[model samples]
Target: MKITTLIENLKNDSQDLINESGLSLYIELDNKRILFDTGKTGSFITNAQKLGIHLEHVDAVVLSHGHHDHGGGLLPFFKVNSKAKVYMKRKAAGDYYFHILGFNKNIGIDKKVFEEYSNRIAYIDRFTEIMNEIYIITDIEEQDLTPRGNKYLFAKEGNKRVQDKFEHELMMVIKQQDGICVFTGCSHKGTPNMIRAARTIFPSLDIKAVIGGFHLMTIPMLKSFSASQEEIQAIAQMIVDENIQKVYTGHCTGVKAYKNLKHILGSKIEYIRTGSQIYV
Candidate 1:
């Protein structure tokens, strides 16, 4: 499998690529070209062009959640890719918001995009194999060590707003002959829980690598970490316990948190940027 970082919060040493506080990965596996996320805008499309990635030929699109940073490029993508079906959690269209400092900001995907590409969007509510060896796992029940940064995120339920349970979050698992590679958008459901969920579903397959943001930033306004050093250590220890071969994370994972994790995980963890390319 080959994966390219289409857009991310950071960039490589090259000045040719653009970076944003979002996540998107172009994945090629089993003769399939899959777009993991759309970043926060059409900038990912621009980067793709620079990287010589043909978005028009993409086979599928997977929105990690309802967050705009993940699905905001749906409109631009639909304009170019006419055949790929976009897959997302069934409840991903819910009214999500980021409430901080007594203010509420709408952070969900654009409703107009949903109405425009209703037919091409696939709303998944359960475990589904979208294609051969490619599966989407939605039922993440083990919630230990969920991101403390998620405290500010909420979803509208009827007339009242409640903390987001993140049922709308999903993980993509690509089962290869040796093991399985996991793709997460922001890991709002918690990285450890997502890994456990994948392991539970595919008990026989080894977890080769986990890619995407861990949502470790607690205060976005000040760019502060929500997870304490001990918490980060625990999360890293969990990864060690699971015996994951590698972890590629960035975006909302926060620099401080990444460094803390790096101090523990060492070479087992690596940061991915806008122009990063990985083969597994």
Candidate 2:
């Protein structure tokens, strides 16, 4: 399997591609072309074209969560990949709000978009295989290492807003040659928790790699959403204990958090950026 980053927060040396606080990946595995999480805007489209990725031929598009940064490009993606089917958690359509300094901002995929693509989008409520060896995993019970500092996020239930339980969050597990590769969006449920869930489902396969956003990024200015140093350290240790061979994380995995992880995981942890490519 080969994967190429279509969009990310960093551009590395690719001056032509636009960068934003979003993520997108184009993956090719065994006669299947899959797109995992379209980024915030059309930038991913442009970047994909430049990277020689044909979005029009994508076999499937899997959304990891309901956040706009992860699913915002759905509109443009549909314009190109008419034959591709979209998959997401059944609860991903809930109204989501991101608490800012003093107010809450609705940061979810547009409802109108979902309505327009209702027939094309498949709402997943459980573990289901969309392709030969790729599965969409849902309802991850956070038995341990739950995500921290996410109290600010809220979801609308009835007429009231409550702390987001992240019921809409989902993950993808792909069967690789020697092991399994797990791809996540922001991991709002906690990276360790997600890993544990994947391990349970595929107990026989070694976790070759855990890739995508870790949600460990903390901007000093946005203190409410950032993970604590101790939490980051603990997450790193958990990954090591789990014996995950490679971790390609970036985007929401804050610079400091990633640096610390790199220190601990050494070459096992790699910073994924725009235009980056990986073969498994």
Candidate 3:
């Protein structure tokens, strides 16, 4: 499989790419082109063009969650790629908010995109094999070590907003001959939990690599870390314990947290940026 970072929070060294507080990956696997996420805006489209990625020919699009930074490019994507079906968790259209400093800010995807492109969107509520060897896992029950940064996130239940359980988040697993590659958007549920869930589902397959954000940033505005050094070290230790071959993370995984992880994982971990590419 070949994966290219279409959009991310950082930029590749000396590369002409648009950087945003979002994540998007272009994947070529099993003769199919898959778009993992759309990033926060249509800016990723420009980055795709620069990288010589033809979005029009993309075969499938998988949204990692309901967050705007993950699925905000749906409108522009539908405008270009009319044939690809965009997949997301069933409740991904529900209202989501970020609560901080006594303020509630809407941070969910645009509901109109779901309404207008209803025919082109697929709502997934269970373990589904979207294509040969490509699977989407939505039932992540292992909640060990979920991100502390998620404390500020909430979702509407009725008239009241409650803490988000992150049921709207999903993980993508691509099963290859050697092992499986996991793709996550922000890992709001927790990276360790997601990995455990993936292992539970595919206990026979070795996890070759895990990719995407780990959501370790407490406050982006203040640039503070949510996970303590010990917590970050534990996560890094978990990765090492699991024997995960490689980890490509960025976006919500703060620089300090990444450094903390790097201190332990060393060459096993890498920080991905806009225009970054990986082959597995």
Candidate 4:
């Protein structure tokens, strides 16, 4: 299996988006093309075209959650591949804040986006295998022991305060010989918590790599907003313990936070920017 980021805000190359967040990718099982989330703009399509990647070749598309930064590109994707299976939580069709460093990005997928392709869509709220060696983590809860990372994420249904509990998100783990390469789209499920779930749900598999957004970077005003350094350290330690050899994270990872993460992970962490491609 080979995982790459076809579209993103930042990139290793000079052409990468500086601060803007964009497209993400998740290819699994050697041939299965699983696109996790679309970037915040139509550039995802443009980037795909630039890379000579055909949207029609994707086997499935999954919206990690309902943020425009992650789900917005679906509009262009829909226009190209109108018949692929799109897996997402049913509740993602509501307005939510893709909160970030001192800004609120509104993201919500309109029902019309999938109205024509409803027959090929699957809304998952539990653990399910979409294909051989690919599993989706759904409605994950916070860890009972550890207490770091973002604890404020929540969901609202109509007028009620919904416990985000990371329920609207989904994660894909691709089994590999050395271990597994995990793909997440803006891990609202808490980075550490997602890793733990990956271990529990797929105890037989080892996580070799992780590639996606870990919305750890919080509001710009650091005076009381943002995940603590202790939490970051703990998460970093967990990754090392799990033996994950490589990491490609960006988008919601906040430039500052990820910089710290890179230092901690050392040679094990590799940030994937826009137009970045890696053979895992």
Q: If scored against the real structure, what TM-score would every candidate get?
A: 0.97, 0.95, 0.97, 0.86
Scored by Cα lDDT, where does model 1 land? 0.90
For model 1, the stretches where C-alpha displacement exceeds 4 angstroms are: none
lDDT of 1 by residue, 1-280 (tens): 9999999988988658989889999999878999999988999999999989999999999989999999999999999999999999988888999998899999999998888889999999899999898999989986578888899999999999999998889999999999999999988888888888998999988889999998889865468876876668767977899899999999989788899899889999999999899988
**CA error at residue 91 for candidate 3, angstroms:** 0.6
TM-score of 2: 0.95
lDDT of 1 at 22: 91
Ten-residue region with minimum lDDT total, candidate 2: 217-226
Give the per-residue lDDT digits (tens) of candidate 2, residues 1-280: 8988888888788457777889998999888999999988878999888877889999999999998888999998888888998999877888998774788788889886689989889999999998888998996888666656566678899999889999999999998779999999988899888998999899888999999988875432252245776777777877888899999998888677788788888999998889889887
- Give the Å shift of residue 92 in candidate 1: 0.8
**RMSD to native for every prediction?**
1.1, 1.7, 1.1, 3.4
Pull out the clashing pairs in model 1: none
Over 4 Å off, model 3: none
